[model samples]
Target: MASSNFNRWLRPEVYPLFAATGVAVGICGMQLIRNITGNPEVRVTKENRAAGILENFAEGEKYRENPVRKFVRGKSSEIMPNINNFFSKPEL
Candidate 1:
C-alpha cells in the first residue's frame, strides 16, 4: 500500500507541483532570511518593548503589510461579473 501510494505520487504530471512547491519554499526562505537580517521590527524583543525603547517609524504601517496581499486586496472578488450585473439590474 505504501509502495502504491509512493508510485502514484511519482508521476510526470506531479513534477510541476513539486517544482512549484520547491520554488515557493525557496522564495519564502529567502524572504524570511532577508526580513531577519534587515527588518528592524524583527530585532524588537518583548523585553525591549516593555522597557519603552520603541521608536515610531513612519513607514511602520507599510512594513506590516505584504505587497502581494495589498495587490490581491484591490482586485474584484466577483467570479462572473456579467452574470452579477445582469441579476442586479432593475426591471422597468
Candidate 2:
C-alpha cells in the first residue's frame, strides 16, 4: 500500500506539473524577499525623509549592513595588527 502510494506520487507523468509548481513557488518567495529587502518606502536614510507608516526600526541601517561591512568598521586594534600590516605598503 505504501509502495503504491509512493509510486502514485512519483509518477513520471506528474514531473512537469511538479517542476512548474516548484519554480513558481521559488520565484514568488524570491520576489517577496527581494521586495522586503529592497523597498525604499520601508527604508529611512536621510534626516528629512518622512518615516514609513509601518516602519518602527532602523530598516535602512540593517539593509545596508552585512558581516564584511561590520568587520571593516570595527577598530583595527580589535583585529590582528599583523593582518593589516600584510596588506598596507610601507613608505619609502
Candidate 3:
C-alpha cells in the first residue's frame, strides 16, 4: 500500500516539472557553448579609436531624426515650448 502511494506520486505524466527544468538547463548549456565559440572579431585599440567614435556618432545621428522622435519633439514643443526654452538656457 505504501509502494502504491509512492507510484502514484512518481507517475511520469505528473512529473513534467523535471522535464521542463531539464529543457531549460539544456538550452542554457547550448547557449553557453555557442557564445564561447561564436565571436571571432578582433579587439579594438588606439589606432581605430577615431573611427569607432565616428561610427558611433553616425549611428546615433541616424536615429536622431527618426519619425517617432520627431513627432514626440513636435508634440512636446507644441505643449511646452517655453518650458523647453527655460531648460535649454545656461543659468547665471
Best by TM-score: 1
lDDT of model 1 at position 85: 79
Clash pairs detected, candidate 3: none
What tens-digit string does per-residue lDDT give for candidate 3 at 5-90?
99887888877987898999999997676444432222245575445424355545654556667767736545677887789885
lDDT-superior candidate, 1 or 3? 1
Clashes, model 3: 0
The all-Cα superposition gives candidate 3 an RMSD in Å to the true structure of 14.1
Candidate 2 residue-wise lDDT, 16-80, digit = tens: 99999999999999868866667546444655255436553476566567556787785675366
For each candidate, what TM-score against the reference? 0.50, 0.44, 0.31
lDDT of each: 0.78, 0.72, 0.63
lDDT of 3 at 5: 96
Poorest stretch of ten by lDDT in candidate 3? 34-43
Residue 9 CA error for candidate 3 (Å)? 7.3
The predicted structure with the larger TM-score, 2 or 3, is 2
Candidate 2 wrongly placed segments (more than 4 Å)? 43-92
- The predicted structure with the larger lDDT, 1 or 2, is 1
**On residues 12-90, what C-alpha lDDT tens digit does candidate 1 reach at each position?**
9999999999999999999999787656566656674476545747546656666877987977889987888789985
Which residue pairs overlap in candidate 1's backbone? none
